[model samples]
Target: MPERGATGPRVLLRRLREVMAQPASAQVRLDRIVKIIAADMVAEVCSIYLKRQPQVLELFATEGLNPDAVHKTTMRVGEGLIGDIAANAAALNLADAQASPKFAYKPETGEDPYQSLMGVPILRDGRVLGVLAVQNQTRRHYTDEEVEALETVAMVVAEMVTGDLIDPASLSGEEGRIGPRLVKGLALCDGVAIGTAVLHEPRVEVHSLIAEDPEAERMRLLRAVDELRASLEELFARAELGAMKGEHREILETYLMFAEDKGWLRRMTEAVEQGLTAEAAAERVHNETRARMLRQTDPYLRERLHDLDDLTNRLLRKLVGEETAAVYALPDDAVVIARAMGPAELLDYPRDKLAGVVLEDGSPTAHVTILARALDIPMVGRVGEMADLLRTGDPVIVDGEAGEIHLRPAPDVLEAFRAKTKLRAQRRAAFARARTLPPVTRDGVRIALNMNAGLPFDLPHLAETNADGIGLFRTELQYMIGSEMPRLNAQSAFYREVLDTAGDKPVVFRTLDLGGDKLLPYGRQLHEDNPALGWRAIRMALDRPALLRYQIRALLEAAGGRALWLMFPMVADVTEFDAARALVDHELGRLDRFGKPRPADLKVGAMLEVPSLAMRIRAMAGRADFISVGSNDLLQFYFAADRGNPRLAGRYERLSPAALGLLRHIVTEAEAAGIPVSLCGEMAGRPLEAMALVALGFRALSMPAAAIGPVKLMVRSLTIATAERFILDRLTSPAATIRRELEEFAFHEGVIV
Candidate 1:
């Protein structure tokens, strides 16, 4: 076999461009192109399979096989060796094509005689447009140079198919219109919204594929990379982002690392040297990287694909002299779509225009999801291949509550969602009207309804919901959102602002709940098999005394004669609480030593997230001022379920007999010890769950601001004694979940929940 080096592929590309430039029908052009690829690579067969639909790939042109099979042979996305390449968006080079498990016999194509095969996906903007493959009779592995040459040719072919050179309709059999479709995903936030799809970080088209001057393109590529790096540095230096330290900053740093990556630059430069424009080179390299990474099952590598795509798109825009930070002119009721994005990228869009967000890849704990919650935007994530199914400006109904996305929905479906949205609005209005009313039951039992908050955006809801106080002020958010560890003064200023915003309303400040999934950018991350159970929250704080001391100092400075309500998170035992409280004591002593004004009233509490803490509730009540049940973590721990895992979503019910019994035990112990206890996790925000907690003798509950009204309404309508009797009786029942029974009780009793 002859070595198809730099000159050979370039020579073939030059000839292919000549054929493409000629005035001919799409079929004639495709036929000639395949022949050129076969002759150049010294292969017995060459074929082009174009994606006509989402799942189906059709052979449009071929050489050295049954010529009659052109436009006749078809395969699904993952049916055969060709389909496997398309499905994974990666290249395949097989020594024995028939011996591969992925090989599927297609008698129509007469491909059985071919023993050696090499296939590469023709990718455009990270979407697999088609598969370009070559085969030979002899069983021999294709060399690296041969594979690179074929990939370069595939790049040229992608341009041809998408371009007017090959009429897409003639090749596929249908127009480009995508019909009505429904996609299911995980609900990251709650709400229903109807909107127009606005693709986030839209691809910059490469108008010029082949380079007129190789040296010029190389220089252009080098300049764009330098510009890309400088722009990222400038973004990092911005005052708003500079002081932030968390995953968002870490993501940007990763982006910068990709921008400056020597290997990434080398690959693009090599592509340019092989006869492609700077933009085309960047696109090709990214396509290859995306193909390789997409095949990886590792979540970390799959996630990095988004970062790589983002960087490549930025570089492409730079190469084309387009605005690197171009702001999109969003349509009314815009539903932003992306593979995945950092919080900062999501923030670039105007909040008012954004009706919701749909991600092909995202997690409930992702930073972008946190931001979406803060902005009060509905979000649905892990909706695979959404980009392929829907185009920009397509009508989209995001049913966040159901975790469903209806693309180009039917008129009736659209109307149904509109009605649902209106009904939701009406319910919210009703809740608002009754917001200021005290949450006192019909039997005159008073329940304290507080709001959980983290971001400054949440502070406004404190007044809106008429919450008694801030029950869980997640202080780690301030640390998470910045690019670097927030300085002492920055932390103090932020806490002070939060306190100022609340005014007279008490705020329970939960100290930095770092580590585990919520890792700090500057802090060292430990490799743990189960991060949730590993060193985090109180454990991490106790281990790093300075972290606790620094936050304690900030809270003290922020309080300055005001009341300070501090809480430690994930305290497994009484000893951890004692150690954490000692740091607080140390901070108070330091304030005294510095002659600084301390909080007028100080209250230190421990979150009962760990099941062990529940066992030691009596011991904890003796030392701690109050106990806030972190039901989200506590339930997961008790049930041995990972809350973040979608597979375990409904496996363990929150209203289960065992879960309620555990909560009842905690409340019983807390009441005996004379400590004011509250339930503050997601269970509190839910009306039905809140009803059950109230029955379990929890007088105080903290939830998202949106839940306050509904929970309050339930509280105002409840007969606590009746609910207690009903719930306690079912505690001994063998049901997997008591949700149905509770709902029945609520309905019969006229409980608003």
Candidate 2:
């Protein structure tokens, strides 16, 4: 056996090349590779375990211990030390093998003589294909250098496994696919929904592995790399992606760095030099890198692998001359499953057919996840290996509330869930009975419970909830839902229907809040580093007056002698608000001069989202006819926390002293100036959050139609005067948790929660 540095990597590579130069059989080459590794490491035993099936790993070759055990000794994932390494995508190193808790004895292997052990997972794109391990006679700890060297060797083997060099069927005894598996994930939205699987991003199968011309293949690889760079540049050049300036842009930047890494390119170039096509070489490198990252213990590193995986796919598409994959015709009640996706891609699906969404990778605060919540779709994210586990139209139940998935569930289990689902429907029906009840407090303080409407379809929900009015009429949804930007007449007709449906109830229209995640497909593409705080909302509208002008003109036309309340979103300062209002005044003058019917009563307002507006709340109050707090964006901007990241979701509590202090300041300023202030964000939808708002001097709240009943019930059961007192008392207590304290007060005061 070679000792210490007696056999370096160059020597091992030469020996491996010498062995392969003979043009032996696949089995012979695989066996020889393990033997050389054992000799180089001076190990008593070295073995290779390939995934014979998704759940089964078989000992394909061995240099010592027992050759008879090859292809015979097998372990299901999570069964033993080797299985654990494959299951968790993590390497295992131990001085004593049998004494370890995960140790499992195999009678056929005869590995009792070996004490120390090291095992590294062979992976491709976060999927484990096999495990490589070495054992020694004496107890010893493997160094970092040893692990890295062995991992490099494992990468070579991974390429062979994924390519035509090795037949997957020959290695696996299982005929085809595995069935009925549970995939864990991060729960994004709360609900339970049963539906058929609909894959958002279908896998692209690569047929060619070896190249006919090495030089041509290298050139092909280079061209694909250039095209990939162009595509990324085009993505950054978009005005629509302005919201992605920080973390989102950083992801692509890191990917570009990896794409340009000389080590990565050298590996692919060397593979091409060794008679593989550019596609084949890149695939091998991608799979090897993916497998290694999947095994990493660091969540951040593991998460970053998703980007590399995405970039690899993009390069392959360029090489294949394929445009972006398209959404298939969805089945009724389809549960959309994706690895990860942008918000625009999620919106492309037909909303009625889409029942739920399950993702292999996504954070709770991701933009698409927020859209899922708004659309009332049950969602679960970070579901590992979801694509491998199920096919299209497979029966699945996505339990977003519990963060569980039931695939091909047993009849008994289905029946149990059916009953649970029915009971939930009954509870919702009971809540609907409160629609006719007045939103007056126990002490007769009048509270306004308004519903927020988006699409034209949302009008029926307003009647169902008997909301006070449409507190926020999101006009952007109309643009988003359309295949192209609707004509000005089309926009006017839609607005007319929305107001007509409300019938005497007031409706506040938030003018086209596009840019960032709300971008229309037909509008000009935006390239922004961070659209959320950048040129979005009022900024986009002000810069592009034609777009804002047309929208306001439509609103004026729709109102036609009735009152028209228009709100400008993402107003940074009082001056921005005045400028937007000036546009509206200009439209009014044009209508008057042209002898056309205009809005009989025009009410202008601003969305309090940016901190600058809050700081100058008094100035805003003096100019604006009304003010509505967009709690979602306001809180998001206030903490400088990306609302799309699940890790930072609970970074700051809504009812915290700091948050309350900000709300109190806004409320005080608005009330002193005699302007009505309402909260129209996700925060107002929850009963607890709405209670907090009422205590902080907010008289009006707007949320989704379903939330109105719960929020209204809380309002009817509590006294604002008492809530105000509770607020004053807690203001002085630094440790006060309004969420808990208010809930306790509500309970004792006979308020419904």
How badly does each model clash, as a count of residue pairs?
A: 5, 18
The lDDT leader among the candidates is 1
Report lDDT per candidate: 0.85, 0.78
After TM-score superposition, the amount by which residue 511's alpha carbon in candidate 1 deviates from its true location, in angstroms, is 2.6
Please give the distance, in angstroms, between residue 624's alpha carbon in candidate 2 and its true position after superposition. Answer: 1.3
**Residue 116 miss distance in model 2 (angstroms):** 46
Per-candidate TM vs. native? 0.72, 0.57
Candidate 1, poorest ten consecutive residues by summed lDDT: 165-174
Question: In candidate 2, residue 351 scores what lDDT?
Answer: 76
Task: State how far residue 495 of model 1 sits from its true place (Å).
Answer: 2.1
